[model samples]
Target: MRNVLVPLSCAALFSLGPTVASAAPEDGRPVADPSSSVAASGAAARLAPLTLSVAIERAMSAHPRLRAAVLDVEASDGAVQQAALPPNPSLAFEQEDTRRDTRTVTVLLSQPLEVGGQRAARTALARQGREVARADLDALRAEVRADVVQAFFSALIAQERVSAATESLRIAGSGADMTARRVAAGKLSPIDETRARVALATARVELRQAEAERVAARHALALATGQEEAAFVTLDGGADSLPGLPDEADLARRLSDAPTLRRSRLEVDRAQAAYELERARRFPDVTVSLGAKRSQELGRSQAVIGVSMPLPVFDRNQGAQREALKRRQAAEAMAEAQAYRLRAEVLSAAVELRARVDEIDALRRDVLPGAREAHAAAMRGFELGKFGFLDVLDAQRTWLQARMQWLDALMKAHRANAELERRLGAPTQQP
Candidate 1:
């Protein structure tokens, strides 16, 4: 019968087939594609065409470090709840036999009663630790968002640079063709054609370099978005009007909401709680037990009650209390340091933002228009044979350089705005 049952069980296991694979222990085999799960679950779909804001949000959701911090907060909350609950009671049973051949059995229950507000102290410490964990998570999210925004802007700037380089290359190629025709007709010297060719080659080299930069920027954006494919990344937004700047008083008020400062404050609270918990440990906890007992020789039964408490003999947690106190002091010092640093960062970023805004305005009002006028004048003079080819080339170069500079300035202003928003803990413009 046993042999038949064993065979039937074996047959049943064999029948399970691939369904049993799920219950099998992992064999330490690497997955064929690490991104297969992300591919199938539409994670890639969500990111396949990502905007800047979407990319930041995706990073905040998917970055493993940020997710771990969030999970730590949840776990700390659970720990706090556990710390608040009273200790569970213990149960015991006993039996004794004497020389007279009599037997006895007994059952007992015991519970350790915490004294000196130990449970309360522990709960407070755990709750404060949980608050610190929550603050840490918030700080991590803020930092990650800032990084993603910067990377997205960098990618956009690189793409714009590539476009500018391509345009420059096209213009240079056109100039080279005209110079070649002039040389063939004996209207321009062969040396002029050679100069034009050299300029075209330089332009082509710049284009290639710009293309490489764009590729790198795309990869950076993909990494920031937690996406493996650059084709999925996109930037559909442009810089909007500058945001209104807050006054010093208003900025000071806003600094209280900064994630880093808030995290530091929470750390101070946690340290204080730890100090108090250690101080409370100077008092001892009492353990009480009750039981029933029987003796074999006398054939008698008895009830027993016992109490035990630790004596504060050599060590009294003095060292631990001192250490915790020092830690609390250190946390307070750290909070002050963080506050000062935040103030300096905010002030510096604000100053830089205002400067960028001024620069952008100046470029719009003066530099760009002046360059355009000069370029137009040079082009007309060259057509009338009044200006030399070098003069025309110089004017064209100056105009292109000025335009590129303006673009760079605009990118700087955008980045400054982002930094200010990060410092002030506020929403940025669409850009």
Candidate 2:
């Protein structure tokens, strides 16, 4: 288990592998977090990679948070029907005794009629709450999707690192073999062969550690995908390759629709509906009663009707109305804050993404080719007795490190894009 939070709501913090650190900004709150890329290299290719959407869909379907949100919405929907129902009627029976054989018998029925638009207001409030719950469900889906995609990329990086470590081990073994041949032929010292063997041993240790990390990363991905047993599923994803960058200008336009911001706005709307309902409650309802009165001895019957109402002098519902108004105001303020944070996040991620793209390009075009050529030349020179064993070792180490850096850069670029999408409250591109 890893102490890292990701997706929009810190959902994956508990299950990220040992290598994952929760340093990325969540939503629009600017935490000075580092990028979530790991140190790794390109190596063994995955046998069958799962697509990003398949991973996300599997995770979302299994996540209880999204299901809970749906249930909340359904409950809110039920409230609407409850709100629309009218007050039930009441019935009463009465008997009065008089002197002698005279007696009076009465039967009455009363119905309370709702006034001041209270019923309509209550229904509106319930409907608004449903909207808010539905919006929250939408946000939940987006967050889960981001988490799965990022985890897939992390696992992919781990596998590549394992391959790179294996490659390094192979190089070390080759150096040791060459040194032994030279020592036998009286060309190199026995101590040189011992040094080569030591390097090979170190490479073997590194390869084992790298393989362990890959296993951990894969397990973490399985957890994020909500596989109950952490099954060994080879995740195949295009997340390693950089997707086309979104237009920065278009991101601003998309802000209004961002899931977090949308939920905030819905909160405001729901609060306003509640406030209106409270205000509508200031007036009292009217209850009308009808009865038949009978005098047994006099053999007479009479029809009677009466109306009743509550006086507002005792309580005008002023306190509740004021509270509702304040709540609505608070919701509006929160919505504004979320908007500001979301806009800032988009700008920040965009700048970071561009810089990473340039770095990756430079490493691919100018750095890697030269490092490879240098290592190759050193190897050839050593075989021809023009270079020392140390020279060859140094060249190989430099090339290995350069490749690792390149891989790190690539992973960082992918993370920047995923963070941007998470903050956007929706997927910017199909994974």
Candidate 3:
């Protein structure tokens, strides 16, 4: 297995949190880490909170899909080694008759030798296949890291919502208390008290819902990090302050380095190698025999040297050669399609991420502040008998709605950034 080169940016984006240490493969192959194998289980029982980097490391180590990919690369290595080996020699014994006095015996050893670059072509094909497997492993590592980042953000967003809901609940409780005292003192109607109580109840319900969502989000995060059971660990960091997006030109330059496109290109090379192997096979191989022959009647032993080759008149590997040629053409076409698809996806993700950034900025700079002011003014006006209870409820609703929308925009922005990094096959530093 090739070494897993986890991008430094995966940790840099969350520099506020702890970092995971990456280990190189031993002798160009993965060695099972007993500690990492149990990392997820240990993390589940941890007294401290979990960090994004630690989650990613645990997933990389214990995730079944990632482990399978490592095994695939190892398997490809074995295949390459096998393909480079020469054919084994065969031994034969012959007897003309069962009677010992008149029996004639012969013994020979034959080795079928590959010719016309057959062995070289075969070895090249296997090496190309190994490269393809390595590319796959690289792509999967990126995927796993991206998934952990996204899941961590999702849980963090949910935690923020829970806080928001709790704050709203406290405000609603205060309003209910104020309305009750006013109703008892005859400054406000009993209906006002009822409305305030209802509002408080609604806030409590929203808080409950938010708490449930937070629990679900935590479980999802645990699953993303390859835990079999929900860890329910506190997330160490927030996604409120993320790095800025990369420039369009920078993203364009990264498109060629994406693992998906790289893998597709390698598939083309592997297919070409396969075609070469097939073409090489069209020429027949030679088998050379050398040994000693003994005749019972003459009581004499003679050396024998003979050579044989298959007649290629009937079978010239035409079908296999044609199939391999078509496959190579197909691989080339697929590589083109993959490149086009990656470009489109990167463009879309960048556009969405920019839009999300704009939206979040608007909500934070304009909408949320305005809504909070309006809600506060409405509460003050009601207390002074200048506005009705209904106005206060409307203002509070608007403020909460704005906050939720802002959080949602933040979540989308982070997710769009994650998607962009995933497509690029690495994390990029934001300027």
- On lDDT, the candidate that comes out on top is 3
Per-residue accuracy of model 3 over 165-244 as CA lDDT, tens digit each: 99999999999998898889998899999999999999999999999998888887877788754454577887677647
Kindly report which residue pairs in candidate 3 clash with one another: none
Ranking by lDDT: 3, 2, 1
Give the range where candidate 2 is weakest over 10 consecutive residues by summed lDDT.
Answer: 36-45
- lDDT at position 380, candidate 2: 96
lDDT of 1 by residue, 378-427 (tens): 86786566876788689879978987887777677667666766665555
Candidate 1 has an lDDT of: 0.79
Off by over 4 Å in 2: 1-49, 60-62, 93-107, 184-186, 228-232, 292-304
RMSD, every candidate, angstroms? 9.0, 19.0, 14.8
Name the candidate that leads on TM-score: 3
User: After superposing candidate 3, which stretches have Cα over 4 Å from the reference?
Assistant: 1-45, 228-232, 429-431
Residue-pair clashes per prediction, in order, are 1, 3, 0
Give the higher-TM-score candidate: 1 or 2: 1
Report, for every candidate in turn, its global Cα lDDT versus the true structure.
0.79, 0.82, 0.87
Error of 3 at 90 (Å): 0.5
Clashing pairs in 1: 48-232
| Stretches > 4 Å off in candidate 1 | 1-49, 92-107, 230-233, 239-244
Structural similarity to truth (TM-score) of each candidate:
0.83, 0.81, 0.87
